[model samples]
Target: MNDSADYCDDFYNYVCGGFVNSTLIPDDKNSVNIFITLNDKVTKQLNTIISRPSQPDEPEIFKLAKSLYKICMDTNAIEEQGVKPLFDYVEQLGGWPVLKKDNEWDESLFNWKENIAQILENKFWVTGFFGFYQTIDIKNNTRRVIGLSDYNAGLARKNLIKGLEDKSVLNYFNYMVNMSVALGAEQEHAEEELKEALEFEIKLTNLTRPDEDYRDQTLAYNPMTLGDLAKRYPYFEWKKYFNYELSPSNISVDNDEIIIVSNPDYFDKLDELIDSTPKKTQANLLIWKEIRSLSGFLNKNIREVNGNYAKIRTGIIKGTPRWMKCTNTVSSTFSIATNALYVREYFKKESKDNVAVMIKNIHNQFIKLLNSTSWLDEETRINAIKKAEKINQFVAYPDELLNNSIINDYHKAFENFEMIGDSYLESSSNLDFFGNKIGWSELREKNVPNMWDSFATRSSTANAFYSSSENSIMLPAGILQGEFFNNELPKYMNYGAIGGVVGHEIMHAFDDQGKQYDADGNVFDWWSNSTNEQYKKKAQCIIDQYGNYTVKEINMNINGINTQGENIADNGGIKAVYLAYNDWSSNNELEKKLPGFNFNSRQMFWVAYANTWCSKSRLESQKLRLIYDNHSPSEFRVNGPLSNIEEFSTDFGCPIGSKMNPEKKCTIW
Candidate 1:
């Protein structure tokens, strides 16, 4: 798609430099777009329905997703049940003081905050300087809230507070000191106990709050209650930890349980670094974050020494293929009892009736971009068209995931679990203790909206989201297909690639933290103090124009107020699929030059939206997604919204101040 280059100087490297110079990037991927090439064709169509064949009247969710994909492709029953079930679950949680031996130490029978609240209620990987979970209460949206917060650290929070003296966070603690000497320790006591567990996660990244200062969704909502977080942080133990997870099921948190303190200055500098460190450096940083999140289900040399710091922060040499991480751990913990056999084998009802006519022509081109915007007013443009007619365009899968008595009553709500073909550390410890014991017995007897078993374990993700707390948008059938959706391309290249990703997730229901949630998805604030000060003065002119755009291939700079709500849904999703393809080519016709490209259908609709954000990455995964991605690079999500698109300089005519015709332009739909 070079076509003599210059689409007003840099149309995303002139149509993503021919698929970022014909793809490649893979040695187990660091980048390759079009949602990782249709999530590697939905992981080779769920590895042909997880290497089929076994069928004795199958269906108990495909025999538990083929016995958790043959217990993660039984590599000699995980190397003859090696790292002895991770050293017998670290000698029942009282050992790994980095391979002990120092006269069998015991800080008076250590409890390290009740084993860091049972390693964050049995999830394991939850890093230490705080993090508890159980969300959905971004401002009392009823039920579920928990939080505890502040944790990001495993490295990169500006290299644990040195704010970049770089050495890729000491080459990720020399790959966790070669995974604590491949789980045996003693290579100089595994490099001084993994450099004192990387200086206790650089003192919990200097006691928190640095994800671009918590992208202010109303100053990161606080809330508190478990007796005002034990009188606002009286050194841990929040009521024997939420009465050891809701008073053994009688479900009562004793001091009016509300717990939302979303980082009161990260518990006032983590109560001065847990009252000046050492109880053996907080028991070697919660036993090095539960033995580095259960050392990649142990064995194959502790999964390549816990996959060598994601191949030194994302060059990704290997990992994730133990039968696609046991078919993505049975498609993300039995996604509503395994996404109805991945939507009855690779979803398609003519691609959900042509993506429900492109989500009804991108919600009538976002009501003609809120009837051609004017910093919104007429009663905030009729409550933003009654919250875009109650958004909810779910798309690709979920129709109760093709209901087979709700996938056999969600696999008979885990009727007596079993994985006879044993070991992936006992099928990931019997599916993490019977999927949290039938997810707290169906969240204490029948809670609803079963996200098709969490979208059947991220069915090879080619994601699309919006949720707002269910105002909905979803999409996922792994982003439909290749260059983002297909039913045979042209309707302006599927309205410039998946109708500009269904108008960038229906313009993320009016961005900036989804305009503080509304249309029944609660957290209410339906605009109007002069349309919320002219929508924060047009979201501070797109946060001072993408915060003076920098990211020159990860040299870094673009946080733009924590990526201004996905750069306002990537400029109102390429102007709602370029005004829903000029209202469907004002009665259809325009498709002509893409075969041997000469760029015709309006420069092939911006080269199918910059070749669906073509590939290339790995400068250590673009400096670890420039400190953990929010989105802004993919060449500023296509030249920061086609340089404030005036129908992209009148269909590439440009001239009016070249460089894609910029002249103080930063709009917000």
Candidate 2:
């Protein structure tokens, strides 16, 4: 504890000051927090599993994952081959115009529209001008449909809007120039052509909307027939593009078929830009995107150039070690296999059972909180309870992970993919095609509701998620270890740490966004108009409360509208879990006090909760997150939630109007 600061004044500092003051952010990372520190342990465990020599008797998925890791780790092969593999890949894409001298390029040969469809079919993963993928139809969550939206830009919309004035945008331009030049383009020519490409990207970004602007799902969800879409935005031939992209999966699209255009205006704006901009500039941007996406996977020189851009983007002084990079890539790309391997080697059944029990207790506490909330009408209150009861809890790894048949079926898309181990670039390209092929293939199959296959893409990570489409909360095996949970820790500490996370995820079902989805996970309104108004009023209090908190380092207040859902979850989570912990303590015998502290069990609980968010971050990362991240900074995450809970003030004996004991506290669950 920091004796200099009082607990009531700054709960986060009092609890986390010692660690934050003493610890340094790792050179390879932009921030160091409890979550990041614990994740390092999980990565080390995965590295041990993936680095083992491949076994002949292992499952095909296991062998494939191991082989992919082996290929990524072979720096000698990558360095020797140099950029030749990438240049060859580019030749197949009808050539990057910037690579050729001005007059030598044949613009007639390169059709950006046809090239886009070809890349989508062959590469399957990289999204250039537009994005097309399967998503759960919001109104009918029982099935998936193709959703089209604007491209995921190289720079974020927020940064791109700043034009060349933004340092990140400037760095991106430099990265583009340097990368094209490395591929044998003349420096001056590459810069001149790529400058137009960069400007085209900025123009495209302006046409698209920011994520914060689309919080109201109705504004974003526009279901249109393929025929209608073709008639409305005729510049790019939507019908032909869809047919070409989906033909590889043997899924045909007719004129009457329905697809969700998430951003309808984007197509209109895009058509205008397509008509005005030169085809050469558009082609350069398209290929530049491909180059940017594959740069990190190329030779050492290309990777160094890529790493330099990352340093500016994330504020890291050094690049991550190669083994760690390869490990993370393998884990994400082969998530199902990684989950199976992680569970078989490390996770215990007892931990799963224990977390399940905690989830049940916290869930019951939330229902009780809803029952007693005076602001909610009786009908709304009852429906809220039913929704809470219906929430599915997926604790630790799914049972399907233990079955080889299911694992193999999940990996059937990669049936044709083989790793030659001679070239990482070729292997990576094939993996991208096969891996992303699964998402496109889903369009052919009706989504089986409440199945683990749809949502278990990432189970071996140190995180928790509440999926609105599934109406479920997933507590992955990765989060069950380290500081988050322990078998031998006191019930209070365990309840305070992981229990808070469990409660937070549960509360999300009633947050601004999640509340829109009903118990069936359909986008239906279950609340009465009167009750809805009351809920909004309560939410506004939270919005205003968090909006006032300024991150002094950045001189910017928190984007309360952007982060309201998370703040609500954080507050409601701690509140429900604390009461649940009290009930458990009352029934069971109170555990003996610890050796170092004189505080009671309740006080220790709050300290443990705060400790989970203990962190130190670089200024650059902090600025970036403040602008984009939905969650508040680590310090605010602790203090912001605690300050609003009267239970915390009473336990700490904080005065009625101290910083931690505000006169007005916002509570909405």
Candidate 3:
């Protein structure tokens, strides 16, 4: 695998190749080519249905067909179900016309509000729903520890204990719980099947590296990771503490230095600028404030429950998982844990330099990619390049922020576990009910930085995102290694796998959602109405097209209406990366093709792009996603976009009118 050709094969076989084969459903010569030849007809029918107003006595068959079509095209069944349920729920709560009867709230509406609140509360518990609450629980020897999970979970448990305090909400919760329980019972069979699939991935990883140690390997880092670690040590969940370290370093402002300021003054400045910020940026900031407030409240609650703060602290430290310790030894929280794990597992130390170099090289390539975009206006392009240049790259760990006294001070402030827990719930509930007044002042404060540093720790994390509010892109340390990046892989493979990801984050600055924010990371609309309209029209075409797809056997409809922004980003990111790759090839005088692959780098680029999104999900999960998630499923993500991209068809030699090559195309950026 060290040689370029071997590296390419390893990459093609292990990473990008799997996606190409898995997602591109081969056309059956004997079967009717419904998708290939009748896309227009199907699309037209879907459009007609979408345009029509609700009518009583509509054909049941039409409803079923439309539902099935939605399930297939959209890759989300849950969302499809949500369409009718949400509409019904809203209407039942009070028809939209009735709710909108008054511009302002009426005292009579209090019943409606109370009903809605009860329903929301009930939904929380059954669905692991949580809301803010204050409670104290005794631990061994009269000590206490604060426990915080999803607010919904707490709320649901409380509702159960209180015997369904609100009848309307209680009934809803009961119905949902019964359905979920029944679903769980039915799903037991499917779980067996899925276990094999999951185990297969694990086995593949194990088989591929038989010589490597497996005892210490961990699943991807997430909030779930904390849960997993807590199973081994019920006394404490160390993932929380580790998160405290990782999140702050993840903050970036327009690719500049990763600044984690807790100064009240900074919060004040941010408040002053909020009105001037773009809507999306403001929305994201508000959301972050909500999340942070929740986090703080959770910490406070745990402290209040535990009488001995030191014991609670010990539990947190001792609960640090072995894998996290190995990954983040430099940090005080994980240093002892890492040493203990190393000794326990007898694992050899790997060079941090290798990981650092990979990150640096990828970061540099992304910068170069940003320099090559032809679509951006010169002024925008120059600023984009400067932003790329300014981006501070922190690979694998925090710099020196760990030593800040704020970390210690935060620990000291939580002198009582029960009070901390109560404070957490109160703070979170207040934030939710009253809006972001705390955020306004907190942003101005320069006392301590917010955000956890676990994002920089080693472990596997599949997710990545660009924070418009922070003006930064975060690649968790866990995702930096593995199939996404390896020094041994060919540049094409790297670009297609991790390189495409880097490009994706970089291009996010210009995505429909991200573009709302300016270079400074403040949200403000800068596009002319004409340009914005043009983009929206193009985006709508994609929505309509995607809305027409169906999942076999399910009566579902994908909501292209909801998923438009993500679709735009997917299409635009692929284009930007491909262009960037071409620029790199031309400037560096690299070989036009990898040995043995017999494809030009340009062709490989699209293939790589397709491969990154290869995934399989349970039908139930798929259904759930349609209702909630913004992105389309993996199969549609590959097939839908590829069919629309002329470049992809040209490379694959997909004849016109083929499933992969449609006569009509939709383009938006």
lDDT of 2 at 380: 89
Cα lDDT, model 2, residue 491: 86
Error at 426, model 3, angstroms: 16
- On TM-score, the leading prediction is 2
What are the TM-scores, per candidate, against the unseen true structure? 0.31, 0.96, 0.45
| Residue pair clashes in candidate 1 | 331-457, 332-457, 335-452, 335-453, 336-452, 336-453
- Candidate 2: where is the Cα deviation over 4 Å? 116-127, 412-416, 454-456
- Residue pairs in candidate 2 whose N, alpha carbon or C atoms collide under 3 angstroms: none
Each model's lDDT: 0.71, 0.84, 0.40
RMSD of each: 24.3, 2.0, 23.1
Worst 10 residues of 3 by lDDT: 212-221
Compared with the true structure, what per-residue lDDT tens digits does model 2 show for residues 468-560?
A: 877899888889988889999988889889998999999899998999988878888899999999889988998998899998876878888
Model 3 TM-score (2 dp): 0.45
Q: Can you give the lDDT of residue 569 in candidate 1?
A: 91
Task: Evaluate model 1: give its lDDT.
Answer: 0.71
Q: Which segments of model 3 are wrong by more than 4 Å?
A: 1-396, 401-460, 553-555, 587-601
lDDT winner between 1 and 3, please give it. 1
Model 2, position 581: C-alpha lDDT score? 94
